[model samples]
Structure formats: C-alpha cells, structure tokens
Target: MMRSSVRGFSLVELLVSVAILGLLASIAMPVVELTQKRQREANLREALRSIRHAIDAYKDASDHHRIAVDNGASGYPPSLLDLSSGVTDLNSPDGPKLYFIRRIPRDPMNGDISVDAIKSWGLRSFASPYDAPRSGNDVFDVYSTSTEVGLNGIPYSEW
Candidate 1:
C-alpha cells in the first residue's frame, strides 16, 4: 500500500502563532482603551458646549425682554430642565414657548445611568464661584461631575 502524506502545523509553529497573536492583541489593547477615552472626552466637550450655549440663549432671551424676569434676576435659567422644557416668549402674540436644547445630555464622564440627565451634570449657578461650583437659584453653567482627570491634564469637573 502506498503511504498517504499528512500535513499539519508543528507544535512549535502553533505556539509561535499563538504567541504572535497574543503580542499583537497586547499591543492593540491600549490603543482601543485610548480611543474609547478620547471618544468619551469628545462627548463631554460637546455636552458642556451645548449646555453652555443653551444657558447663553436663555440669558439672551431674558435680556431682550422675551422672557419675564425679576428686576435683580441674573437672566439665567433657574434649572437645566428649563432649557429643554421651554419657556414662555413674551414677544409672541399668544406667548408661545421658546426652546433652547431639545434635551439635556447626560454627563459622558459619569457612568451613573440611574441618574437623570439633568442630575448627571454638576450645576453652577450665576452666584457660584468658578473655582468652587455650587447649584443655586439659577443655573449659570453645567459641568461633568466626574472627578477623573482628562488626558489633557485637566479635571473633568473643570472641563
């Protein structure tokens, strides 16, 4: 009987292949993690910018007499919800509601999904100090509540 040839990878070759694969995977892991971090950071920046712009819009409306306010009011919104929930526009014939942002974005840096979007952010009122943010009667600005430091060496809370 003629012998049939069988071909297969040697044990050493298989181990080497596996080792190479493991090395490649090891090299790729940090890159994957870094990418994820960058993405989240981007989201955080966008969220902050959106909230800030909405706050500015509210103040602008109040300044223009479009939204009624007390004589000494800062013209800022009373709460984050006010931005998305809409406000009465005095300029409209029927007092139509004026909308800023459709929805307040959750803090990307904060992984607490149980909290509502409005609560996910750290609120800074018109009366609060920048170095020490605190919620007050009016929401002057919004920031990430995360205590983690960013890749740029800035605290997420200050971002």
Candidate 2:
C-alpha cells in the first residue's frame, strides 16, 4: 500500500508557525518601544546641551564685549532667536555678525509638532529664579516644556 505524500506544510504546522511568529512579534514590541524611548531621551539630552552651550557662548561673548550690549543688559541673548539669527559683533571691524547655534533645536520630549520649536522650550531669563524658570527680558536657559517623566524617573522639564 502507498500513502500520499504531502507537498506542503500541514494545517497544524502552519498554525504553529503563525503562533510562534505572533509570539515573537509581541515579545519584540516592548523592546522596540524601550529603544525608541531611549533614542528620544538621547536626542533630548543633545538638544539641551547644544542650546545650553550656545547660551553660554553668547553670554561669554557679551561678558568679553564681543557682542554689543545695551545699558543694564543681562548679557544673555534677548531671545532664543538671537542665538540662531546672530548678533552684531562689537569687536569685529565693520561689525560682523556672530552666531551661536545654527538653529534652535526642537524639544524631543515635546510631542506637539504644531508648536514652533522655540516655543516648545521653556525659556528662563537671567532675572528668573533657577528653580522656577520664567521668560523675561532675555533668554538665559531653556528646558523642555513637557511634563512627562523620563525613563530615568526625572521629569523632562527638569532634565
């Protein structure tokens, strides 16, 4: 007696294969989410650092009389725009413009793409308290406007 040979996988075999694939996909979902979060966090850190450094550079330039300052000015940029838009250099002949960061970076933690990148950040002026950031005459520092907590358990605003 001769038995028929199956040319392809049986129904049970296909079902088992699908189940295994589904299981793997489910298992990978959380890891993919975690990786995405980590990447966003890293981006947040870099954006903060770059903006902060630009602020510092602007301040240093002001302190050294490189950038023109008005009477009673805090030596900080009047706005985040100044960092990217550039400032008139007082020290340079013919007043060449000085630029800090090429452009203001969007806050990675801020999910609102509708808002402008500059507006997405919480600005602090020199007059504002360190613990309580507020916008005033000049932009002294920037923080994420997002209130969400990071994977590190620290609020994005505080980061």
Candidate 3:
C-alpha cells in the first residue's frame, strides 16, 4: 500500500500565532495614534503661522498707509473674513483689492470645516490681553479652539 504524507497547523500553533498577532497589534495601535496626533499638531502650527503672517501683512499695509483704516482701529483686519475678502487699496483710486490670504485655514485640532473656519479658531484682538485672549473688533492673532491636551502636555488652545 502507498501512503501520502501531509501536515497542517495544529490548534495549539494556530492559537499561539493569533495571540502573537494580537500582541503586536496592541503594541502598534498606540504608536499609530501618536503619529496621527503629531501630524495634526504640525498642521495646527502651520495654520497658526499662516494666519499670523497674514495678520502681520495686513497690519504692515495699514501702517504704511497702503490701506485705509479707521481712526480708532488697531490697524489690524476688522475681521477674519476681511483678510480673505480683500481690502481696498488706498493707493488705487479705482478701488483695487489687496487680499491677505486666499482663504482662512481651518483649525486642525478641530475638524476641518470650511464653513465654520472662522468660528473654529479662538481669535485674539490687538486690544485683548495675551493671557486672556478675546475676540474683539479686530483679528490680531488666532489660536486653536480645541480644549484637548497635546502630546507635549500643553493645552491646544494655549499653543
């Protein structure tokens, strides 16, 4: 009589493989989460920097008399929308528009909602104190509105 030999994984071996896979997955999950969080943090920083730069540019133009500003105004953009919507150039009588940003960036800490971009950020007017930032008549600075703590143990709003 002729016999053929074949081998298959035993139940014990299969169980051991599944347990190892579970252990590896458990270890990888937190690392993946951390990487994602770090990416968001980087995005947050970039957004903040872009907005701040625009604000500075608007202020510079105002200071240089390139753009007309109110007497009591802080020379900052009246609102975040004003930056994206463009401002009237004082140098041009035909009313040429000077745009600061193409569009306001959404807060990364919060979900990226284009419609609610303005509301998602914590605005700090020039008149408002740094320690207690508040939205006033002007847009001087922007911060994340999220209350979550970052990986560095600092509040997202403070960053």
Best by lDDT: 2
Superposing all C-alpha atoms, what RMSD in Å does each candidate have to the true structure?
Answer: 1.3, 1.4, 1.8
- Cα deviation at 132, candidate 2, in Å, is 1.8
Candidate 1: worst 10 consecutive residues by lDDT? Answer: 87-96
TM-score of each: 0.95, 0.94, 0.91
Candidate 1, residues 1-159: lDDT per residue as tens digits? 999698999999999999999999999999999999999999999999999999999999999999988889899999998899998888994866999999999999989889998999888988989998999899998888898999999999988
lDDT of each: 0.92, 0.93, 0.91
Worst 10 residues of 2 by lDDT: 87-96
Ranked by lDDT, the better of candidates 1 and 2 is 2
Off by over 4 Å in 2: 1-5, 93-95
lDDT of 3 by residue, 1-159 (tens): 988687899899999999999999999999999999999999999999889999999999999999889898899998988889998888995867999998998898887566488778989998899999999999889999898999899999998
lDDT of 2 by residue, 54-146 (tens): 999999999999987889999999999999998888877476699999999999988889999999999999999989999999998899988
| Model 1, residue pairs in steric clash | none
Candidate that beats the other on lDDT, 2 or 3, i.e. the better one: 2
CA deviation > 4 Å runs, candidate 1: 93-95
Clashing pairs in 3: none
